[model samples]
Target chain A: MALKFLVVDDSVTMRRIVMNSLKQIGHENFVEAADGRDALIKLNSDDSINFIITDWNMPDVSGLELVKQVRANPKTANLPVLMVTTRGMKEDIIEALNAKVNNYIVKPFTPQVLREKIEQIISTVNV
Target chain B: MELTNSMEKLFEKLGDLKSFFIYGQKLIPTLQKILNFMQDTVPLLESVNKSIAESTSKIPKATNQLHSVSNATELATTEILDLVDGISNELNSIFSKTSELKNRLQKQKELAEKLKSKYQNDNEIDEFLSYSLFDDELCFVDASSNKIQESIMNITIALQVQDITAQQLASVNHLINSIQEKLSGLLLDLNGKERESDKSSSQHESITFNENARYVKDNQSQKLADSLVAQTNGVKSQKEIDQLFSNKNE
Candidate 1:
């Protein structure tokens, strides 16, 4: 199944790798943003985006803040967010989960792991 | 009685004068002692005044020297502060420049990596294409036939096959050469296209390798070309053997 996925990361390399991996896994429809602010702008304009994969620390409006905003908005309240970041602190994980992130994948992950995590999140959200 | 009273007054006057003489006699020693004391104390007071004047005169000179020293100290301190500030500014500038250089270096590293990956991907595509087209098993029989024809062309007429058979062989060779040339040209075109695509974009553009494959599949003349070349090689080898036997009999 092809889902419209939004990939938010400050690193261009990381964005390309993620997009390529997703494409390899058979997800063709994807949008990219450099930071949470850009992601918010994209989301506001495109309501059809159902899945979001974002990095944690960014220059403007971090992933956690984006998640909170997404959860708060009635239009995007039920949107599924998967945080893929290098922040492995327990407190950060708890905070992200509290902010309504549906899933989390750590950095330095293989394409297979990313595919698995995306599948798990899609399944859990039933999107 | 008046004369006696006057006489008493005179006597009192005389008595007072006598008492005055007695006091003067006693004061003479004390006056001499006072003169000696003045003689001894006058030079001491003069020396003290002179010394006091000398000290008072030197005080201003000492104070001037102290002021000059203080001024020099203040100037030195100010200069030192200025020097320190200049050094600090230079250090700050250097640090900022170093930071900028570091950023540039990081960006360069990323670019080099991207270029390296692209080169590797290009090489992989080249290898795949080369393997598909030029592998030992996949080489067209026409290429070998062309090599054989070139060899025949190099040989002397003494070894040349009969003219009729040679004509037949040459015609087959021409067909084989045409097929091989077309295939090589197609492979070269594919390589050129791949190189252009690599140069134009970092992003993966849609490539239609399958389309080319389909074209290759639809080309029925290639099969006929292959068969003709194979037949020609077989006939040429038989002719060569027959010539060798005829030469031996002669």
Candidate 2:
């Protein structure tokens, strides 16, 4: 089955690399956004999107805020969000977990690590 | 009374002499002790003063050399500090330039990779075309052999027609030669008038054929050139159109 994914990042290069990596792992059904706000707009319009991969720091509406908004909404409350970011601080991890992110992946990671994390999230959420 | 006064003067003179001898004996010991103490202490005081003067005389010269050394040290320390500052500034400049060079190298790498991918794609397309156009041995052989056979067939047919026409023309030439030989004297007089009329008529026909062929060939060549130009232009324009479409899609 194909999974619909939403990838959001402020850097064009980062977004392309992530998208390419996902494609490499046989995940071709995805859309992109430049920031959390754009992600939100896309989410509001599209209900079939089930997975989100986002960078933590962005221009408007940070990833944490987006996660909070998703968890608050009834329609998207159960959507799985995985943060792929450079912020490896312990405080950032705890904050993301508290906001109910399904999983987290740090930046500069190999595609294999990303695939492993995605698999973990799908398995856990599917059950 | 005169005899008693002479006896008293003699006794007074004897007492005065005994007092003078006792005073002289005490003055001799006191003078000898003062002379002995002076001779013993004078050399010791002179030696002490000479030693103090020698030490005092060297102090100013030693102080002047110390002052010169201190000044040299201070100047050397200032120069060293300036050198250190210059090195630090140079290091900072080198670090900044290194950072900029790193960024430029990264950009160049990205562009090179993009160009490499494009070239690879173009090579792949060329390979595909080559494979499709010339892959089968039978097809390659047939194409060349078929052109050779067609040219041979055209030449053979043309030669056959020319041989038949030459044979018929040979018979007509023999009949005309026989007639010329049979009526040579009478025909020579009529040949002059016929030759003039034939020349005029043949010239008219040749002029008409030349004009017609020239007009037809020129028109055909012009049309052919126009079509070739249009075909090439279409091929060139198609690439530009494709580029525009791809850009729009991106």
Candidate 3:
């Protein structure tokens, strides 16, 4: 089965960028969510969403909170999450790691970097 | 009897002072964290600016790459096609304006350099002063050099927003620091001495403050300035900041 991704970001441009990047990598099946709350709703509604790529800073329900919520829920606990964010500080990375994000990529990353991170996570993790 | 009453009142005041110090001590770390976060925003803003500037500068290059890639393979989705088109359309105007500004600045720098070399020697300048057009030439060259200098200075000032913001953060850090220091001083006055643990905790905060100060000081405030001067055509990206830190660690 082809992997389905949930691309969550507040910026429509960034979401489109991620979507375009995914398309370049031959992964066309994905759902878009504007924020973490919307992402939770989509994740709940769609059982096919095997992976998540989210931005850290959002108006409501941040990416870290989303990761924590995902881990707390049994249905989505094992979902692979990759954090793509502008928060590049060491402390920020540590916080994301502590929140149990599968991988982290700081912006503005190349599409190739995004592809590799996704592959790295997908290959290592069951999701 | 009078002395005993005065001593009791003094003890009560001391107790209040100690309580105030304890509360102030509790707030130090959180304040430190906020200041650090604010300090971090400078680089974040600079990164945003760099990305915007670079994207604008790379429109043609990116458009060409898209053309090459699309020619090689069929696009997998409409989203990809839209994204490429969007990037091309949005950045096209910006790219043209940036290119025009870059060319003008380059020309200005070259003219300034040429003027400087022409009139740099004082003896030659003196001999030329006897000529009727010397004043005209002098005024023109001086104006050109001043214009070039003004442009360079403006670029430097623009990049210095990071430093300015960092300084503001540092000021807030210092204000909180002074408050903490005063609180500690009051506690010491009340107790007539410091407890070992309280002393250690205060020392820890002092170390953290020093660390924050050093972090600010170590920042390459001149990185943008230097790069702008060196690569008049190619502005450095966020990667330069990343590379700077990595190199520092090495």
Cα interface RMSD of each candidate: 36.4, 41.1, 15.4
Considering just the first chain, candidate 3 attains a TM-score of: 0.98
User: DockQ-based ranking, best first?
Assistant: 1, 3, 2
Off by over 4 Å in 1: B1-250
TM-score each candidate.
Answer: 0.35, 0.34, 0.38
RMSD in angstroms, all models? 45.1, 54.5, 26.1
DockQ of predicted candidate 2: 0.01
lDDT of 3 by residue, B43-87 (tens): 886676566445434443443443344323322323444554565
**Per-residue C-alpha lDDT of model 3 across residues A22-101, encoded as one tens digit per residue:** 76567989999989999999999999999999987665688889999998999998898998765555556555655667
Which sections of candidate 3 miss by over 4 Å? Answer: B1-83, B86-250
Native contacts present in each candidate (fraction)? 0.00, 0.00, 0.00
lDDT of 2 by residue, B1-250 (tens): 8878887887777677666667667866776777767776677555654544444344334434434453354455345434543554554465566556556656665665566577876675555444433325434555654565344333322222221222233334334333333333233343342322222112111110001111121233333322322332323233553453343333
TM-score of structure candidate 3: 0.38
- Model 2's alpha-carbon lDDT is 0.56
- Model 2's TM-score against the true structure: 0.34
**Native contacts retained by candidate 2:** 0.00
Off by over 4 Å in 2: B1-250
